[model samples]
Target: MRIFLIVALLLSVSFVAGCSRRADDRAPGGRVIVSYWEKWTGFELDAMQRVADDFNRSQDRIEVRILPVSQIDVKLMLATAGGNPPDLAGLWTFSVPDFAEKGALTPIDAALQRAGIGRERFIPVFWDLCSHRGFQWAIPVAPAALALHYNRALFREAGLDPDRPPRSLAELESMNEKLTLVELTRTGRVVRLPYAQLTPAEQRSHAFMIVRAGHLPQEPGWWLDLMGVWFGGSLFDGRRITADAPGNLAAFQWFRDITAKYGIENLRNYGATGGNFASPQNPFLSGRVAMELQGPWMHNFIGKYAPDLDWGVAPFPAADPAAGKDTTLVESDVLVIPRGARHPAEAFAFLAYLCQREPAEKLALGQRKFTALRETSPSFFAAHPNPHIREFVRLASSPNAHAAPRLCIWRECQEELRVAAGNALWGMATPEAALAQVQERVAWRWDRMQARWERVAEARRKEWLDRELP
Candidate 1:
């Protein structure tokens, strides 16, 4: 009886001591903090935070601290340059290429290989963009491709069936003409699609019109893709850009004709004022516009802001049904490891896990986000009731989905396009002049890029040749 009592007393004392030690060891709890930077805001941000919360709850080794950065490129560059980068980050795919080129990113291939993950796990085009100079750089999280979002109310009111949307670019033009309304006031002020003034429908329309006129390329090797289908010519010979090719000029001229006939307000300063897309005042939501070329997220915006507004989803009208084949632009959000991160291994492990199909789908659902890593089937979408939400996944999986050229000058390229379009819309330059200027700028940038690559390639070759073979 005496011995038992002594043993119990000893055990009690030990337990107390252990508890005290744990308490003393904690400095705001023994949480290993991992800082994460992401560009998503609004509902998109909530979704990302949920993923972080889930990951944190799943394990105890590390706690993720998410910082929502609005200007992703600016913040990320500053952090990297300052050598105090976040342990993990979420960035757009285009942003990753530049980071990888500048050595601001770390290669994650070793971690991916260790985890037995492969490129086959993600959508091919998204995966392709993450590779820079023969190294895997980042893990893809969400993919959003360009699709069609149309106002069904307008179609029904126009005495047309909303169920049947435009299938080709020609059909879209015909529908636009039918849906267009020109209300001229007694004061001689013309108001077309009065509701369009309520929202940024004109800007949205301009982007689609640019596509229809074929100013953009469908692929890197093709002559401007938008033109190849619209004007019937390729933009490249595989060796150089053929933006000024005969077919391309015709396509640009056709696009200029639209601006010449209509007012430029539709193209410029149309959508710049709207703060949020998911609002009742949205031009498309208000039924001021008949059609839109946007993404699946627009459906969510409508559900939250204007559920009563009838709408339908469709593929973006093809420039030329016979020639365009089903071209769609594929873009994605990715997780990148900044250079000189403190715990790169752990960061990459978490990223790799999230990039896998099952967990990715779960994270996606919980956050209402899309996945760049392709899901196995409809199991993920089947769980969600809205069919429109699945449109991005469907289009992303389609054969027509393709990534833009993985050039380092991609930033300049996008800038050129934006400026050219702006100038054309503002009446400062005709479509042909704007495009010709863009071509010239592109040619100069390409030359610089080629020179840079040649220098790097030559050095690498020499290094290999100079080394002794064992």
Candidate 2:
């Protein structure tokens, strides 16, 4: 199946390139036409087009033609390999490492320096997302930070103060217990349990914090860096793999214990009741669940579907309050110039314009997303759709904010961790045993990837030497 997909991708790229070449020859005004592929749809697409239209009107030397594409990352890879890629693309931050290592992307350091866009202008975590292995590959446009969103009405119902959120793991757990209600059938079987009923995304976020609190070892080359940083751990120690570090084992065990305490079956039953996340029937909106971990986008859903819902947003509590205060996981959609772009300089010019304060804020507000910039004007905060925008911006600029594990195999590693977590949660394997399997599998994959890259480097070196000496 993978091979078939690869072949299909290459064929599509060839076809598209032919079409693009013809289109370029007929473009108006002899202006440098930069083709940009983005992954946004509907309103988001409109927002981006507004920015593009403004950029075009601002200068006549260059024109950015925005094209919305599905599965953009795959298409990007195929196009770049075929030697005909988009002038610029908007990609998930996690895709940077893979694209950079594959030689499909152009480093943006020189372009950024020429534009006088210093790293200090960006939120620290968002700025870090642009680089991999010491090379800047992309620039962040819309960044997000995770926070705890709780129903104020639920808090009052549980006899808890609506204003004071949990400050530590113990407090959060206690609040969860109080907010949770158990309903039973006539046969005494459990029917509903609110606290344990979380989406997979929420569950993963919780797992990350648990692992971090367990004091996981710093040098382990594990996949779960969002959790690792809290414990002062990194996913890699140079090129060495440390998947089976002592801290990771402890973290997995902790996760297993928490899962067991909640009763997996009950959690599963409650989770099955959830409706579409963006719909009116959403667990949080419908009052089926009292609390959730979500981004600012949730506000849009709430306002659209349940305007009367009383909710408050607060910083996600840490396992240890003193250690994890203000720490956040930052994610973003980034812009990059592909390797074979015909208008690299002009493409970068548009990128630089988008990164400016006004355009950045405009796009962010359009999507209800936070700006990647470190500072914003007072008007931005006041007019933002999200009432909690200030809190999110604060977290974005926090000293401890971090991006996810920046590795080429991050997606693969995340899948492995999910499987291991499932095994432990279902009691099919002991936490220690499940994590042991993860360590073995991930280490092997990492080693294999390293070998492949090394071989590529060697082949390139030999080819250069032979050509020069001959």
Candidate 3:
């Protein structure tokens, strides 16, 4: 009996060990875990997580862990500078150039080529924005463009058809004049400007939009490149900065006239009348203002905040009706592979998947954020249908959409332009003078940058010359 018991115990132990080994053999192995960071919080975060979840379940080789990091730009800068970046991160399109220039990113040309995805699959402007200094540092995931948002109630009150919106700036100005009212309070009469409440940042952004449309005067005022093109000023002889141009001067003059002579409201007083631009009680939403220049987010705002309000979305009015074709200014959120990444190749694989139009739409649909890709699934729009959402979706994917300048100096230039636009609106400086200062500053900075580039090029040329001569 004792011998039989010992044999039984040994057989049980051997059977258990064999089963454990078989289980281990069936387990999926060699997973490259990628740590990802993004700015999206709340709904945006949820959408991104859905994509990550899908990718994780699709295959076992790569496991993507999506980390939510608000204030993404500051976080990315600190992380990269500290030499400890995540495997993948979502960055703003503008910051791509800045990050790439500083060597904080790895180029994805080979990955893109390997995947058989080229520039043609994406919006040209957004693709160009990601390409800086001859390298592709990031991939655009979502794109937004500016458009005109008008209150239908205001249009009806002013004796106009809400469905038939303004096709020209002159018509819009006319509508604004009709909508303007002077409210007589007990103390005194207060001005109720129709198209008021735009911040200095918004105003300058609007000016940039207008300049792109070629309506603002041309020459070297404020941002001469914008004014230069509008005013027909030549900033460079195809090589160096040239500030002297009639186009620049005209742009400056136009800037001043639009703020002062026209019924354009002051940025300060306008803010008091309504909540912030994103709020439900925003000037445009609350009927305090008849029209506004806003992005695709407004679609969500209207659906969630003021569903009953009638509104129309159209492109920013062109300077020359014939010349300007419904152009949208494209901005985007990008996914990047940071330097020192633990799993860069895996990170890039996820990024490439994110850029795929169908999966991107699924994510956008889940989050309620707008789509950036050219081809979105029909169900995405069907699920979140606002009045002008389809129009925005159409514009977002359109070929005419353009990206704002990606030059490193763009931040400073934007700040200066904002200040100048405010000064012009408040009558602190004539539009022409205010814009002139901006142009002057840009010229000085541009010249300095050009000189530095020239010297670097000259040194490279000399090195090559010497090598060849020897």
What does candidate 3's lDDT look like per residue over 18-113, in tens digits? 754322212247677788888888877888888899998898889888888888878888887777778889888878866765557777776777
Candidate 3 residue 1 Cα shift, in angstroms, is 63
User: Which of candidates 1 and 2 is the stronger one according to TM-score?
Assistant: 2
> Which model scores highest in lDDT?
2
| Candidate 2 minimal-lDDT segment of 10 residues | 210-219
User: Which whole-number lDDT from 0 to 100 does residue 363 have in model 3?
Assistant: 74
Q: Which 10-residue window in model 3 sums to the lowest lDDT?
A: 211-220
Instruction: Note the Cα lDDT for every prediction shown.
Output: 0.65, 0.73, 0.64
User: Which segments of model 2 are wrong by more than 4 Å?
Assistant: 1-22, 185-234, 241-251, 455-470
Judged by lDDT against the true structure, how good is candidate 1?
A: 0.65
**Ten contiguous residues minimizing lDDT sum, candidate 1:** 211-220
lDDT ranking from best candidate downward:
2, 1, 3
Residue 343 error for model 3, in Å?
1.3
TM-scores for the candidates: 0.77, 0.83, 0.76
RMSD of 1: 11.3
TM accuracy, model 3:
0.76
